[model samples]
Target: MSPRKSVADTRRTRERIIDRSVAIASVDGLEGLTIGRLATDLGMSKAGVLGHFGTKEALQLAALDGASAIFMRLVWEPAADAAPGLTRLTAVLEAWNRYLETERGAFPGGCLFTTAAVEFDARTGAVRDAVARLYRFWRRRLVAELRIAVARGELPATADPEQLAYELIGAYLALNQAIQLERDSAAPDRTRRAVARLLAAG
Candidate 1:
């Protein structure tokens, strides 16, 4: 009889599965994720993969959670020390730009959340709802920062934090597309210039 796996061993296996799922979902949309392909890629039986998640849809949701965890670690955690307000917001944006440029190992195609948005925008399902939740969480975070910036006079009193948050998030999305779609060599520079112009506006 085969030896039973330890709890730690099982947890490690789950993390490995989630890591692969996030990477694949980044390149191919969540719809592209399948148990057969994952088994083939990971050299595990389809049964072994299914043992962890119990179903394909569950695996996809796990991948979304994994991607969100990675995104926060790379983009937001690095700016934890910055003073809240414009300084923290600027640091977060810089970290975000670096995430798009340098997180190739974690996300080969681009941001998985952004990719999921395009894939599931027109669809109605648990997956679409999960994607929308991640986006809303990010927008709220930016709006909070913008509110602080306005209060600190880093931005004018007349500034609308909600609108500014919308534009800031839009800027990051454009940065992702410029890098992933256009293959623009100067994508970072252009994004920085655009962000500066946005901040300078009354």
Candidate 2:
């Protein structure tokens, strides 16, 4: 018989399950994720999987949260740590590229939230609301960083932080989708160049 798990071991096991769920969602879309498939893939019993999450919706929400946590660690935190201003602005963009390339395998379909947002934008309720919140938060952070850059004289005073932020985000989103469909590494590099040009123009 298997030994009983300690508290830390249980937590670790749960995290591994969530990580697997995020990977599955990235490739399959959130709707395609299921406890049975997750259990089969992870070699855990359905009861073990269901023990971690009581329902499909619960698992979806947990996956969304897990994806968000990774995004913060890989993209947001690094950018936020840079000097507030042009340095931070560039750091943010660079962090995103790094996440796409270096952390490629983490999200099989690319950006989980990006895919989920488009999938559930009009669906409404907790899941949709959570996605919407994450999107708004990211955009606001970008704008804030750009504003700092302008204030510090790294960007032109005339630059509209909100517009620039939107453009940058739109470009990244487009590139991410293209990369997923075409399986091209150049897509992310193109995004990097576009961001650099935008920053240089500011």
What CA RMSD would you report for each candidate? 1.9, 2.3
Clashes of each: 0, 0
TM match of model 1 to true structure? 0.96
Q: Which stretches of candidate 2 lie over 4 Å from their true place?
A: 1-5
Looking at model 2, residue 199 earns an lDDT score of 83
lDDT of 1 by residue, 51-79 (tens): 99998889999999999999999999999
- Model 2, residue 86: distance off in Å is 0.7
TM-score of each: 0.96, 0.91
Q: List the residue pairs that clash in candidate 1.
A: none
Which residue runs of candidate 1 sit more than 4 Å off their true CA positions? Answer: 1-5
Q: Across residues 7-126, which tens digit of lDDT does each residue of candidate 2 receive? A: 667788789888998998888888988888988998999999998788888889989999999999998787676788888878878888878766767797789988898889989888
